[model samples]
Target: MKRLMFSVLPLMVGLALGQAVPASIPLTATATLMMPDGEAAGTATFTQAGNGVQVTVQVSGLAAGNHGMHVHEYGRCTPGVDAATNTIVPFGGAGGHFDPGMTGNHDSPQTDNMHGHGGDLPMLVVGADGTGRATFTTDKISLTGENGILKRSLVVHAMPDDYMSDPSGKSGARERCGVIERDSFETRNYPLPGPQDFPEGVAYDAVKDVLYTGSAANGTIYQIDAKTGNVIKFSDGGAQGRNSALGMKVDASGRLWVAGGASGSISILNGDGTPFKTLMTPRTPLPFINDLVLLPDGSAIVTDSSRPTLFQVTPELRVRKWLDLRDTPIEYQPGTNLNGIVALPDGSALLTIQSNTGILWHIDVASQQVTRVMDGLNNGDGLVLTGQTLYVVRNKDGVVSKVMLAADFKSGTLQINEPLRGLRFPATAVLVGDDLVVTQAQLDKRQKGAPETPFQLTRVKRF
Candidate 1:
């Protein structure tokens, strides 16, 4: 492949730049970077840090080397065909580095000075394996009040940026580009009734047309009208266990069972969100009861991350250990043992191991034996089953996988028929009508400032 360097190649490209301050103050802005063919390579999330801002970039599908990445002036990522190489020129219309100050200096972020162009940023370093992560703090940008990068574009060059270059550093072609949207946690298509208490689990009542969500920090249960977006407090943590609610499910009888993440308890609520039964953890002192799936007899099979154990809540609310990771042959991390579960009709359940396994396994809840069902999924958080199909949600990286499970539950095939739509670190989901309502957990473990964002449930069409 030929290079598109300013010194070696002819200069035939021109880019337009613009700047605008958002009318409302936003806490965050995100950019979804894409390749020249308009394929999403990864995401760049900019959040409000201390005085400046923190940009965390997770990218893939690039050549191995240090690629120059910067914020451009335009919000457009228009692609055009190049006459010289007969290849697609990515983000051709996204203007050069933002340069609101017009200092016209290519100052690399590592050695940046105040006099450098505001658009100048640190080089985006990619690895040989096609994935990269670059986290940096910039005092030049803000996601808060005036003159922020609300309407800008992020550009990833084809080559490295030589810090002292006059125009755009000696970076090569614009391989990847994305538009930075000025959206915050507060802004959403759905209306939230009260302050978001950082919810992680969600359950939809198809018969009643109401959606149930719970707070992971306080165990406050919220009920929202699926059609009108009307929200109200259902069950306060006082009546139920006051632990952090993590996973939730409404059984066939309309009873809701909620998993207490850190408190190691399971609380059962009536269809009206009335407290029914509360079962505390067994044996272990520190437990992370993460997710749960209901059996045919209303027994809940819960995944405990820190304990490497599965607790079963019987129909009469008797909680006991149903499975143990140490008893199985599958190798996995202790604390990150399992998350997200789905029960089959034949008394078998599918579970997700978050860390080492990174795959789905079918387990006999009665025997405590597990068999591998599928692999290649990382950080799978939640799964919803409808007939023979399962939709698994990966919380750390927002994406859903549609898997078709066989009738015997012994085999399943994973297919990516279409790319998943709209997800902000989804934690759990429930199918409501034709749309699936997903709860944004906004897990604060990895990202610096995420849990502060308003927790929301996004409804997306299920394929």
Candidate 2:
């Protein structure tokens, strides 16, 4: 681990096959190995590198020779008696082996073979002093995405492996086991571009390994290549007249949809600066289109801060008024009603009323009927929904709340992490790998004087 930290690394293109890989983050997963007799064996730490993973193993009380080390499919270590041997096998519940692609071959980890299992790891060698310490790196495993090994189990074999076995090597019984779990720490902050421009909306494209954010001053969209940390203007949003953006999202099609704050239009742009499509909202007095939620079919439910309405844009590029939250007590702010919106697989949306003191409202997209989800958001600016967890960015509070939601959207009372640090009035945010790339919009007026520094995006690690 010390060598890896000081050595210079090269850019990695990732695995052979095209996969959904999240932006890189410093992830370290540890496994405390315990023998069948409950003896402390050792520990393994998997830290994510540039485009690969660096595994550091420090073990004691092992034989002074080569031993098999593999990541098992299941994050469990069950003790069961093997029928053939009639002996208790420790870590039996860890399953056969981790093969995200089900490639039934176990090859040498040093090889450039793409047909091998994702969990194929290098061998571990113990010294004459009964201590094993080594660091190995591989591009097959990642910390995020479908093929990630974050939740897998690391196992040590009772004997050495031949390295060319079909499923697993002749490496005997599973000895020590560790289940990979997320470990968190404070993240380093990266500043955005403009000072007073206040970049508002943010989105992430995992495939491209890039993040896109829009400015509230010029409606220009800038793409930040996560790998190289290169920031460049991707689009001027000139096609959409008066394009001042507030919220943004990249749909399944990889197209960028930006909400026109006062322009009252949704501008669609390709990954490049080219124009894709545009949906115009009904002209209302100072129509403030704040945020939007997308459906699987490419349709979107948009929030209008000026009007007590929710706008729907069909996949066919047709725009229509969907719902109205007129009568509901939504903590209405004339030009800033709803700020952030999260769409569910069930077709409902959870919207945050920024001006209403972080009041979240759940609206049935179909019926337009609204229900209060929760309150006490602590100056919630933007929202992100991953699985069942709802992360609300509290701009004024200078932290992020990781909220676990109940099955019913009507009520979501859960424990949140002790607020995260290092955010200066962040606004819109999107998840990329382990980092929540957010726009430091400073819309909440965190700074009293001039725009302190050039506006910059904040990359936060959300657990």
Candidate 3:
């Protein structure tokens, strides 16, 4: 009896310790996502609840449709044009969809009772108007544990998951995804902003000498005194529809043209924020217009990240040419979610291929010839040119490289003369007065499970 008691005592003690201490008790760290074409990306925060997690997701610039949201198998997102090549296989290379030795359909009714897999979350549906607000809790897993969530990723599918379907649920494709890793000390400071930092869509028409800034999140687009960021209500539009001013431009005629993304029209605004005219977009399987760049030759170029091509449109928004500008085999980099674009003074245009690899290509506006000018920088987006120098912005490292352009376009040497450091995730930049104003799209990280940062615009003195 003594010997049996001694053996059983150790066994009882071991069991008690195991139950008392959870394996790291994996908790939510951060979660974020990118839009399909890479123009828009947001983050979220998550917290622990009983045995599950509560998540809050707030986003800007999402189309009104059923978007797929799920906790991915890993928590690392490579930002740049070539992110596809930068993806790290899940389970440290174990396989797809965090199974952890379990397998079943996504959100299977029997998931809890059976050997269930990870990577299942409720569907995120946005209205056709492109505005979305969602908050939900999940009982699947956490971010920290022997088999925690940080090792996984949060993904937004291109289509809605049917839930009980096997494999990838005819949910189209993985449109946008963000990583959830341990944030560095500096990264923590740039947490997602609250209701205070929302940007009012600012309209600047060089021809009209006016600027209008509006925020749909707050339901207002202030006609600001162009010299000052003060509100002047020249007009009002309901925020129920897609409220994104995806891209805005002022034509030589002093008219404002904007692609209201989810609203399905190119709206021309007068100096006082009044809608002058609306050109409806054609219905097709192609991606919608997110931005437009006016060319010197009276033509326009727009980016629709969904179709993997650049559409040249007339001022009337009619399609003139379709340029399939996808990266070639020799230049293909992973995670290339093509985004920002600009028309150079020389009549050529530059475009950004977001994520995995950073690259800018010079497209011959007249001949449709494309050539690679810069390679291997930060996540290249938001391009600008001044005199003989070209400026490219990096997303991941938050540094802008000022390169000196040579006389030769084909052989021009790109020298990083100035590196704009000490900023957040700088996505796009514009020439604001004598200063180069840059936008911080916020950290792709998450809190306990709120959404990632929306977008913030900052400036740097060019003196």
Highest-scoring model, TM-score = 1
TM agreement with the true structure for every prediction = 0.61, 0.57, 0.49
Q: What order do candidates take by TM-score, descending?
A: 1, 2, 3
For model 3, give the 10-residue run with minimal summed lDDT: 6-15
- Pick by lDDT: 2 or 3, better one: 2
* Candidate 2 local lDDT, 181-253, one digit each (tens): 6464344445566655678888888889888888777787888888777888788745558468778888887
The candidate scoring highest on lDDT is: 2
How many clashing pairs does model 1 include?
0
lDDT of 3 by residue, 1-463 (tens): 0000101000000011112312233233465656644454677666545445566665556677776666654444543222223454222221235443345445542255135555666667777655555576555644332224543566666677776665545565565666555332111111223333333233355544445443323334444333444445554455334355545667777666665544545666766556777665555554445556778777677765454566666755576435765543224334434556666676665544444456556676667677766666546655666776666666545456666655644434544322222344454555655556555443332221222243344444552
Report the error of model 1 at residue 258, Å.
0.4
Which regions of candidate 1 deviate over 4 angstroms?
1-196, 237-239, 346-356, 365-368, 417-422, 445-447, 450-453
List all candidate RMSDs to the true structure: 14.8, 19.5, 18.9
**Global lDDT scores for all candidate models:** 0.68, 0.69, 0.50
Where does model 2 exceed 4 Å of error?
1-185, 237-239, 327-335, 348-354, 417-419, 444-448
lDDT of 1 by residue, 224-308 (tens): 8888888988888556556577788887888888888887888888887777777887857778888888777767788887786
